[model samples]
Target: MIVYSNTISGFNHDVDQGIIAEKVHNELNQKGFYNSINEIRSWENSLFYMKNVLYSPSINQDLNIAIEYNIPNTSKRVDFLISGYTYTENPIVLIIELKQWEKAERTSREDIVTTYLGGSNRAVTHPSYQAYSYAKTISNFNSYIGDNNIEIKPSAYLHNYKEEYRSELENDLYTPIIKKAPIFLKKDTIKLREFISSNVKKSDQGKLLYEIDHGKIRPSKALQDAISSMLSGNDEFYMIDEQKVVFSTVKTLVEKAIINEEKYTILVEGGPGTGKSVVAINLLAEFRHKIVNYVTKNSAPRSVYFDILRKDKYSLNYIKNLFKGSGSYFNSSKNEYDLLIVDEAHRLNEKSGLFANMGENQIKEIINASKVSVFFIDEDQIVTTKDFGSINEIKKQAKELGSMIFYGEDYNLTSQFRCNGSDGYLAFLDDLLQIRDTANYDGFDGDYDIKLYTSPTEMKEDLKKLNEINNKSRIVSGYTFDWVSKSNNDIDVFDIELKDDFKAKWNFSNTQTWAIDKDSFDQVGCIHTSQGLEFDYVGVIIGKDLVYRDNKVITDYTKRAKTDQSLKGIKKNNNFVLADKIIRNTYRTLMTRGQKGCYIYCEDENLSKYIEFRLNKVLKKNN
Candidate 1:
């Protein structure tokens, strides 16, 4: 007899016959990867755990199982099997009805176990529970007699099935006793729950079930062990727990690369605070390797090497001679390091493709440049609003390229180490990315180190105060009228006020005071002047042009990028939607750079409200 396995294959088509309840289920089915029951369970568990993992790592739910006693004169046995890990002294983890294919409904609507599944058992007599019990019994009977058998129907033996097991559970007389049982232990119980609750899915059902039963399922012990090892000891540098190490999986993998000292290619994926950049730094330090070539989309070209310079830690002059290009200039020994670490690799897009404008994949260049290649891929961190920046495509590229090479693999850093020590932002981020992620915001304080000030006068006062603390380090700048060096005029006011005095106030005329000019502030530039760059403190000036027009949706990104105009025969155009997306992304990047603080100036109330809403939501809920 065929047992209906949860791991259904080739079942992506809509099966209106109670396959799944709604459009959401259909959407999940179409994703192709959600083929197995285990996968479905994992998706739900991950979403649930994501809500509390960071904020309440110790939180746990106690599962209970109880069976009703039935008493009468006859010594009859009505067996109802309780599945899951049966405990000797503890409550049953899961109670399941054992029904043969001969019967359709296993339990009646009055069965107490129906309400005990996902909901609490406190209200067993609730209307919902009663309905479930009755419906289940009927369903169980139908399943056994003739479910999906077309011609056969249950009307044939309807009387014989219902009368037999009716008294076993309904009355309060039959005493329960354990017959045979496995060793009941706490760790094993937790492990069992975690195992059965694993999210990984397999295409085949029989094999999957067997695998689960035999303990061959899950995130391998190796991965968990690695996470456990790193998290065992608390770090003096950072206040964190064992679970926090999951967030640094990327760091661990990179450190492994350094120790192995062998040619390897790795793709690390995660949301913010996953420690991609910091891990890169530590990896380079551990290997004593010189950084020859560096590429980034959102990081400031100058600040790309900020950590090393700030600490005077290591020399990476070898990069000067590795390649020849507009920004290629480094000095170091021959073959200084055979490792290439690309930060924000998701930003490497089609426009940035290598092959000297031949449209060859640029990532291939990085892979070929070093014996070992490491990429920090975060599609959520695409700040430049460029078309080519996507981590999803990068994974595909890596797989396709790896097929041509000898070895290639990818890993996801599970925990979010940055964006504060909490997981709220990570939860929201998962939802934003449309992944089934759940997280809690308990005890989270939604406050940022940076403050948003729309008033220019208030901004100036704040910047002055911030600068007083560390003028050389803290930068105060805004977009300028003429930051676009290629433009014919110094400034193009597409939509804002402040154009009349933006550059002059920043003393742009004197190159030493402003970093935008090659001849001037080689280290510091105003916000507009520092496009594509970041700093310790970025004070953004949202000029008056930012307004919510009645029909204008600044989020509509229909314009060709500054780099894309050459490919398509179209001049640069500013669609509000695209502009809004770019602006938001830019702000996110800018705000995140400050190790300490950030400030924003936008007179527009709607835009301010939006910014405050997002920022506050992340900060307050993510603790």
Candidate 2:
């Protein structure tokens, strides 16, 4: 939605009155979004300068301008949008990605430049491409543009950049995107006006933006469906905003690494459903001809993807070998491969192998085995005690390996592609688990089918019904129950037994792809088998490991299944801190596996009631 919209003349008056920034702040506050003081100040500075850019008499003063247009289903926003009609009276929108930079330097990576941001000189997405990607994101997901045929023009305006450094920003490496979405420096204000005027010569009463804002948002395809299409040599998941920026930046770095024989490491940090796997898969697709391996500590995702993507048994030889466990590279020679795209990098262990005595560090070994390494990580998903992956560890390894490192918004993924594109859901989840204090303590917005159930039988019945529709629904739980049938070849031995005759089996010991197994619905999955994957519906069974006690969420380490490996030795010297964290994170991850819905069955009545109470505050309907 447009936080603030007005005629060009009206915006000029507001800027002249020095209330434009205040208006934006007020509107964002009304929408329950947080804006920092620096962001408000930046808006103030940019709007004041934008007044000059829109002062041209040749341009239509009656044209509409919008500030901070919230893109549908994503946390990213358009900095500025001007809506008007083309010369032939067709509706069009100009998306301007505004940047306030005084100076910048060229990076060897294409579509990337080093600039001062966030208190450091970091590699950032080139402005023109950023603008283009934002526009493309809007067009791709917002159904209104395609339905109505409204034209979209994207460009970047760096009001503080000098004319002397024009050549640095105008590199040929970014030509294709720059040609599509031109960049305007302080000196090019008149040129920018001419460009804007050429596209939008008349006003359209701001109706186009109203429709665009209210347009229907196309839902992200199911993860397995997207992966199948992508593996079949089709571009199923289109990279949006930073996903595109990170993809392009990595491509450039890989090129440099291959041509110059240099080592480079890219670190991308994003929360769940931020398209980390999509980006990693796209990278593998792009570099399929080269020697590259897709690595992850968990085999669930790799196995499921291989199960879906493999065309036939004979075709699995090369494609199957491309996916390796994190421990596979421990003994590899230095620079043994070209690229190692590690997803769920936070789950990597310090040591490799089943005995955990092989490698000094998984991060160091992976980086050593590849000329260019890309790590997709979310620190919050480090649920196990052995998860040794972290930003500090990766940076340390890169430094010791003498590899160039890149990490920042330029490489970070922020869009919420999962959980129905509701970042509020994730924030609410964080607060629900008491993992972190957040503004979303009550609940989240969106039609995510979440319900707290007092009866495990009801939760499982509903989830099983959902599974019948697409086989995309499954039940997973915390490691509260032991695998009593681990060595027994019988399926009747139940590991999880709930009241009211509710009983279930852990996934069969030899079931490789438990996620998609046709008869797997009757079995239960744990954090190890459910991580790095998603489903349409999920029923989470919260165990006594976590309990709502004394008006707050608490954990009992000893309640965890004695056979569970995730928290091995976590209780040593009373390591309740880590145990508590892992327990909460496990439930959080389990509950979020559902794209459409999440049902909960809590072993503790207090925890179940607490969850129901919190969810009732935000969700209109709760069972």
Candidate 3:
């Protein structure tokens, strides 16, 4: 996935002609990327600065070079990569994160710094950590590096930064990452050159680069399997990028809170498959020495986690106490808990309790009751009217409680560990669902499988076949049916009755662990039973609530089952627009639950046709 690769001599020639930026842009265009003027100009300047560093004849001119090399299975790309052999003739790759920051300011938070970027002073990841993360991601997922013992050296080059203020970025808070990935300033030409020439001794003639480009990337571990293994002491998950930075940063903050009696609130925002739950569970495991609880408003994920731990034969009392509802903090005394790791924070309601009347606010109560509170939330994934979580809401609560707030890259998760690690898939989904106006989204670029079936029975049969490999594929639908089987004594009663004799019951009557239950795939799951969970593959049934009419996507609240609480009070407010969004978002969440693939069926033929058409166009573009 290296968009542009050449020897140092060839790269220098392009730059000497002042056409390196044009060449890079052309390479990117061939791969369906359109860079803005600013990015193009930055590439030009960064390459010029790199030219100075590589001018020494002591450096091998035959060293392999790459620009904008896309990480396998992920949409993220490294700015520059150099491949060669070390002095000992071992395969090595050097990752360089190019930056143009003239200055930066330190924040109270670890792993975060504020700098002028994108025309504003913004909180961003420290250059050192960013570079280290790029290397870590490659080593972890791209098994070629790990299996072949390829050493990766990561560093950041701030060619525009002055030497006088190096201490600002070299703060003690960032010492750990800086040690792993050093930072070079504008005036450190000799230093940077020495760093390169010291490691890269011999050229590989692109052999190492070819293996890197064609190497196998390990598939993402099944979410349920990973969580279950995590519950044991195995720790089968690896945190990458912000997941790593966020983990270390929060660990430090939690230590401060426990040792110094400091109160802090961290707000971590990320979309689906950003490994939110994985990170939350990692924290729960790390701080088990202290009184800690994994809190969430969703019972589906909790049930699945509890089941996973139960299989390990953890004590029943420990399981119950470890996985708690958001409502559990309503009546706790101040700082009663050492740490609160809240997942699905977007589903937290304003009030706590069965009837939503116990607490002033769930966010406020959690902060009040814990020495340190960590919230993992995604507002767009808020599928119900009851969801009260948002970036603004958490900050407001933290401020009101006089708690130190940790935001920005230090607390956010950005890497996509699902949907085959294709950010384009999520962007294409947003465009298809009309959730936002996404530009240039043809399709996702990954090995993720997406299929549209005209027949519901066909979808189920295929998905059921997939589930046979591992009990990790199941069918979920919008809340478009009632639980008739729950009320009937007849075991034959079905809750979901589709045309063409497609009949099934909801996972409601099944065990709480429907997500991983062996026979549960025979039943259908609603948004409640599937949210905050994932599968190897999923079959989604888009009901009559959503359809294509007159060349536009439409939602009909009346078509939804009356028992569904997702849009309960929205109709009363005549919030048709809001209801429409919920319906679309509900499906979006369901479609994305599959890690490897997704199968879809629509009740409306016209809707099916429209979706098939859109999917075909994307497939063609990707091909």
Candidate 4:
């Protein structure tokens, strides 16, 4: 939906009189949209410059103009959109991204530029790339764009930038994006006008804009093809007997809910490596007619999935809509989505925002926003005190919302898909970690590979060797190292320093695709970046937060890094028990991230000896 729309002549007239900003603000307030002072200033600056360019005599005055057009099913909005017809009477939409930046610098990342934004120098998407991505998302999701044969062209206008400062914005690294969508500077106003008039010479009387605003949306063909390509020849997507049963049951429930116009909530509980994500992705691919989305609180799993499915430049736009964050439903309309498959529900936060006070509980909002909400959760994966997602909370919210709850063994996935499909390794780890005593702690004799190393250096070397055979191997550590270098450019600075010259840096904070980045194997991943993800072989570095003492496992919250927000304010006497649980849960989650083997190196010598003794005792008992 667009906040404001009018003919080109009307828009130019309003901007010339300095009343367009107020007009758009009033319209947004009428629609119950939040209005910020900065947003109003941006609207004033961008629209005034847009008016100056569109006022050319050669530009058609009857072409339709839309401002602040919201992308479908997302909170993102485009700056300006112009819809009209070309000389041959073909419908065309020009997506214009306006920036008021006077300066920008190149960054070491792809498709990102550093600029002064939000009171600080931060990295942001390049204007041309941003505009192109928005246009592609619309073309891939909006049914009208596909059915009506509308051509979409994207461009960026930096009206405040001077001609002499063009080299910074148009560097050799940005040639591909500039070629895809030309960037117009302040001195290029006449060229910008020519570009607009060349594409949209005729007027459509706002009919095409109206159609786009009220388009019937379905999964685009590109979305389906992307999913198909990702799932091809991947045996992991195949479901076993129990997983198939769960999938069939949930599919039936969703169909019934859609027909009856009723809300349904299904809680699918499983342990680590039980194919929860696999089932969620399969359902998303199968339910094409319905408005479906896959939600998660952690970006690790989502990034890996996107990196795999986004086969080409255009595929990323279509594939992004299939996944969303848990907090994306803050201001959503009730029952707007047909199905929301929430993966890793254990990571859902109670509140979301910079200060964590913007919205209500995410669980309640998600329940209220969809006709069918399927949550895939593993309660043991809640590694932080802020994570409050539990089966009881979901049931209580479902009961309060008057939605039918499907809770039973049929909805639970008991079969294991990871760790070489060995459920015994999971039970053994749980027993060894003292999270619970489900299995005998004598020894782990399962087919899954398990080893303990006294030196972190040797473990790293072994992991690197294993990665050569299969690239799906990484080293993960506890939250005891300072990651200050993550924000700084010195990502190569070793954050985790150990004896014997074993040093490694934490994973790059801006590395959205850390799971697939070529240089990430040398870095150590923390719990935040490794959870909800699996590797073929994993090397774990147990920090000093956990140690063995007095013939029992003990925890010291003080050993955790001050930068780690998960265990910020725990007193030894006041919250020791709870702090211990969270720390153990973090290590447990990290240890189980491997699907084939797990190698461990503990910081505390006592803890290492204790683990070795326990394993030897178990071996003796088995013999």
Best by lDDT: 2
Question: Clashes in model 4: which pairs?
Answer: 442-618, 443-618
What is the C-alpha lDDT profile of model 3 across 528-587, one tens digit per residue? 899999987999999999888998878888898877888878868888877887888898
lDDT of all predictions: 0.35, 0.85, 0.85, 0.80
lDDT of 2 by residue, 76-184 (tens): 7889999989999898999998999998887766577878988887766788877877787788778889998988999999999987888889977778879999999
User: For candidate 3, what is the lDDT?
Assistant: 0.85
TM-score of each: 0.44, 0.86, 0.90, 0.62
Give the runs in model 3 whose Cα sits over 4 Å from its true position. Answer: 106-108, 171-175, 228-253, 259-262, 355-360, 390-415, 444-448, 488-492, 497-501, 570-575
Q: For model 1, how big is the CA root-mean-square deviation?
A: 20.4
Candidate 2 accuracy as TM-score: 0.86
Clashes of each: 58, 0, 0, 2
Tens digits of per-residue lDDT for model 4, 1-623: 78899999999989988999999998765543456899999899889899989987899998999998866533357889999999999999999999999989875444567788768775566788778767876776589999999999999999998677788889988889788888998888998998999999888999988999888754212122234554443322434434555676677778877899899998999888777877887778777557888999888777777776664443775667778988888898888888999988998988977677868999998999999999999988888877878999999999999889987665677655566555656777788888788645765433356789988999999999988864778999999988767667664566889977898888856687676676789888988888877787899999999999888788888899878888655663476777888999898888888877789999999999988887776556444
Better of 1 and 3 by lDDT: 3
Clashing pairs in 3: none
What's the best-to-worst order under TM-score? 3, 2, 4, 1
**lDDT accuracy of residue 426 in candidate 4:** 70
